[model samples]
Target: MSADYDLLIIGGGINGAGIARDAAGRGAKVLLVEKDDLASHTSSASTKLVHGGLRYLEHFEFRLVRESLIERERLLKIAPHIIWPLRFVLPHDKGLRPKWMLRLGLFLYDNLGGRKLLPPTRTVDLRQLPHAEILEDRLIKGFEYSDCWVEDARLVVLNAMDARERGAEIRTRTECTGLLRGDTHWTAMLHGEQGDARVTARIVINAAGPWVDGVLDNAIPGIKHQNLRLVKGSHLVFPKLYEGRHAYIFQNKDNRIVFAIPYEHDFTLVGTTDALFTGDPDKVEISSEEARYICDAINEYLSVDVTPEQAIWSYSGVRPLYEDNSGNNSTVTRDYVFELDDKDGAPPILSIFGGKITTYRKLAEHALEKIGGFEDRSWTADACLPGGDIDPARFDSFFAEKMAQYPWFDPEGVRRLLRAYGTRIDRIIGSAADAGDLGQHFGATLYEAELQYLVEEEFAASAEDVLWRRSKLGLHIDAEGQERVADWFSART
Candidate 1:
């Protein structure tokens, strides 16, 4: 099968999906193909904070910091249900950066990008604030600041769903085997369950995260590049450690910061260690040493100790960083760069590298801007992603209403659905009128209605796609529950 489109995007991660949504909203004929489920890779495995990159302030990445800050607020408004405000308690550590320097950074972080909506950063006396009570006695002074937490994988699906709503063609589990230039167009081959198909497009975008270089090597052979680095980052999940709703930013002895945040209700998500990677992205795993390193980092600041056995789950993903030749993995620029090659007047191929979850939307807009004269103007800033319709200010009230409507649902369960589906809960729950109406419950919040919704609307092709990526129910659902769900999915599909 052959279809002509204005733009063809590779990789269905945040950047690719974001670009697809932006291009499609602008009325471009768009096709996006993902080798796996959307956000099955680094996107879903992120620490999931929509921050201005507070640490980047030390590096003086002012522009990136400001843009990310603005986007953080914008995303909160756009996806009120999935993305919401999170307060981080950064305990003071005299050994690392000094208090004055940290204070200056916070002051700048507070005023940067015409601060609005989110509360400004404030100095916290660890002795006075109840949130800091869990910290070790050595930490007395701290800073509390605002950032947004995201359902990272859901964000990708929302963008793709929104793009499809605007007429973009999204192919999941479709491998883009090759690309070839032909006069004024590029032909891309994709293999999937339906067998091989070809699509011709005016422009090809290589947003293939960790595999961008590989795509160029295989799809557009003879292209040379010396400007990308792959850095592997790993995170671990353990049983909930602290009772407070806020998160912690701990300063490790090695100069990297570790985050311990509330995750998936009963778990605390902590991570990540950054190191240069030398293997395939698909083969990357959380090594035993990485787990030990992460646990040691968390144990450094907390009164309680975390061990390897305590880590219930862990994952590793490689960041396709734009190589600046920085000596340290943590010091590399988080900003993105674009490479457009258009020799002999053929259709151009644009490749993207190095981006954070916070800056994906803007990255898409800018990537399209640099797509040269072939594409239309940008239009994603004002567009709302799927289920992002609620006004940011009203999310609390909306959540309250959901709790009131489903009085039978446990408070935790209601909040989980609201946080995951946002304004789309009505679609998931429908008019069931009670808890039983949600269909078979696999475990935790894995109701049949929601799982079916994901498969039907969000392109959930497998049980892993539903359990791990679309939702983090994999951590809550027992092995037996997972087997049952897998069996049910196989029988039905």
Candidate 2:
């Protein structure tokens, strides 16, 4: 039987969305399905930094760090609106990782990826104004380095949107229930909002992330495909802890690092405990222990002390890391590995094991190359996602232009839109002379127009999808406004 698509990609997370975008750009007929919203799980739950993993130097994962560092600049260039540079302060605590050693690692990290575009690491005195009042007395010395911040969920959505524009079919709220291999093609059973349908494809890519093993078992029965080590990373959102745009990377006595980042204007994002997780990925939540650990880690470096009860919001996601049999969960290799099963010219199913957001574009390119059908090229590196066509250095100019163009709208709301939509801000504010022209007021800066644009362009089906993932408006929008947005969706459906 003939195949319905050149590529059938399962999972709508960053990896799968990226693969769909790249493959479709190469002229492949692609179909990508997700059991939930794009980036609803791990992709949306990242620490939201596009860094080279400075600590990875300890484990000596040079290649991974190098690739990530290189991608850091590339991503910033391509998506300047949602991505930009931020400084990180790594203090030299006396008892852990010596100062000289830290210098050596920073040196390597600085030069590893042909460092350009971002500033290099430099030493600093934490005794200075910002740090003196914020951090502990002992943390008098530190090094400040650069990394880019990303709207993680927006990255995934933009990739999927780009793929759809390139002729790929992206189906959210769609699940691939089963897979059957054949000589020339594979058949998949899909259960989605419209009901069940069977589809065929010449190649299948299993980028299911946390559910990779489950998908593998469904594809090739009778084999226990226990290749994943689900590591749960959780984060806490607290009222602003410090007064700087710079983020802090605190080294704990346990040899782990926790980050305190400036978040959503009103809160500090602190987090990311590396604990082994065996629960359902969908129901992953921050354990009380993890929360306390994070608070303790924060207390060690910051002058102000915090308790678990003070946290306003928390989230957790399991990293579907390839089980490398490491002694510690924190030390598990983050590099990706692939499993290809195509014996004697039988239909091939490529299963992606492990990967991080920083290297997702490289991962997609490599995955396509491994499958060996599309034109092998670096087209994606040069191509821009949906609204990311502006030059990185000129983003401020672009924003200024948009602000001027929509002078009648609230300046702050326009700024937020530009950050989320980039060049596509016009799509929402096109020809609207005033705020009243943008449709009904839901709450805060959210109008019916922007919400409509999200539903129409970004595949947003719910209020949570709008306020939380597509943008962090949930932090600012009031509860009555949020409920009205929900009502608006329900009225439409």
Candidate 3:
């Protein structure tokens, strides 16, 4: 007999993980399977902002913006460690959108989505201390507004962890090779290192992201499933573009926008072109033209002149946007659209299209609503995820407490740990008497205790999962350090 479930989620992105947590919390047997690590694709490759999509205002996405803005504060309240306020300086260029237009939009943005928690927009002079030193001389004035930065990958992981804690089955590196529908449930063939297995579920959520259409193809073959417009967004990480924690939103000549945000304590994250993608999603990479376009956009707004070669690292991901037949890929709706096929009271499969990281929670709620039968028993909005029980207001105070408790360890390491693990830092270090007890230091703050905790608690199986997604120690840990981590995993495997 196949293991059965109430819902079988086909992807482990933010959407799938969020849905799993929501459904599992409501007393439903849930199984979420990912062909790769959670957030390995679009979820982790975002700009990492829980913003209201300020640019969406130009496209008149007011409802989407409002919903996102409301969720922003709510998300911050629940997971303050991974989500927090970030101020964006929007410089008014000469040829781009005028000041009056910008101010009017800002007014609407400020009022929409029941703005709270984050501060309102304020005008600043470019001739001021930080702005004068950072922005180009031509940029005399700009508007600073509130948005929030998220540890994108961590958000997905936390949701999955919470779902697992709530009795949901989260299977990573497991592919649904074939999905067979029965009269009342789905027989899903899963392929993983443990070998093939079959599972049954009353409902299936096709949140396969870039492969949403492909999942549909597996269930309903012969007919092409082409509701997606794959748009490749690429980002370049340069060695710290200006100082301070404040990020900049640069307006380009092509009526698009690019962001330069402080990243990983030692780099600036930028880029995200809207080039249409048709090839394999796994093969997505930044094109030279796109790289040059990003460099030009950076140069246009900031005084810093840079080349593509200056970037130390870059990453790219394909967004599986719902095809609205829009002329421009960038102008396509970031809003999610759902397709539910429950023809003649048969088993239903709901496929999700589009959607950004900011609204994943709400998206999950709505997905459940579309699935039907679940009560108005929603509870995630007020609950905390994993170790995010710390008061959002006391993130700093909590950090200080952790620092004081671990005075024997590097303060920087403690801060990073608290930020990454929140209250669960105790799981890794509670018993450790000193830094030496944390075990073999891989590099930087990475230790054997932390590695063991990641494997046992956070579902981290590989060194890449620990170094890249779990924490960005890949940037800090030297090559020798990285090899040691790989060997550590290798020895275990």
* Candidate maximizing lDDT: 2
lDDT by residue (tens digit), candidate 1, 278-312: 98888888988899998888887777898988888
Q: lDDT at 315 for candidate 2? A: 87
**What ranking emerges by lDDT with the best candidate at the front?**
2, 3, 1
Q: Clashes in model 3: which pairs?
A: none
Give the runs in model 3 whose Cα sits over 4 Å from its true position. 1-3
Better of 1 and 2 by TM-score: 2
**TM of each candidate vs. truth:** 0.96, 0.99, 0.99
| Per-residue alpha-carbon lDDT of candidate 3 for residues 1-493, written as tens digits (9 for 90 to 100) | 4438999999999999999999999998999999999889989888889989888999999999999989998899889888888899999998889999999999998989888788999998989989898888989989999999999999999999999999999999999999887788889999998999989998999999999999999987788999999999999999998999999999988899999999989999997789999999988889999999999998987877999999988889999999999999989999999999888887889999999888999999999999987767989999998788988789889988888888898988988888888999899897777989989999899999999998888888999999889888998999999999999999998
Per-residue lDDT, model 3, residue 361, is 96
CA displacement after TM-score superposition, residue 91 of candidate 1 (Å): 1.6
RMSD of each: 1.8, 0.9, 1.1
lDDT of 1 at 248: 91
**Lowest lDDT 10-residue stretch of candidate 3:** 1-10
- Per-residue alpha-carbon lDDT of candidate 2 for residues 1-493, written as tens digits (9 for 90 to 100): 5799999999999999999999999999999999989999999999998989988889989999999999999999888889989999999999899999989989998999987899999999989989999998988899999988999999999999999999999999999999999889999999999999999999999999999999999999999999999999999999898898999999999889999999988899998899999888989999999999999999998898999999989989899999999999989999999999888998899999889999999999999999998876668887888788989888888878987898788878888888888899889988899899999997778999999999999989999999889988888888998999999999988
Note the clash tally of each candidate.
0, 0, 0
Clashes of 3: 0
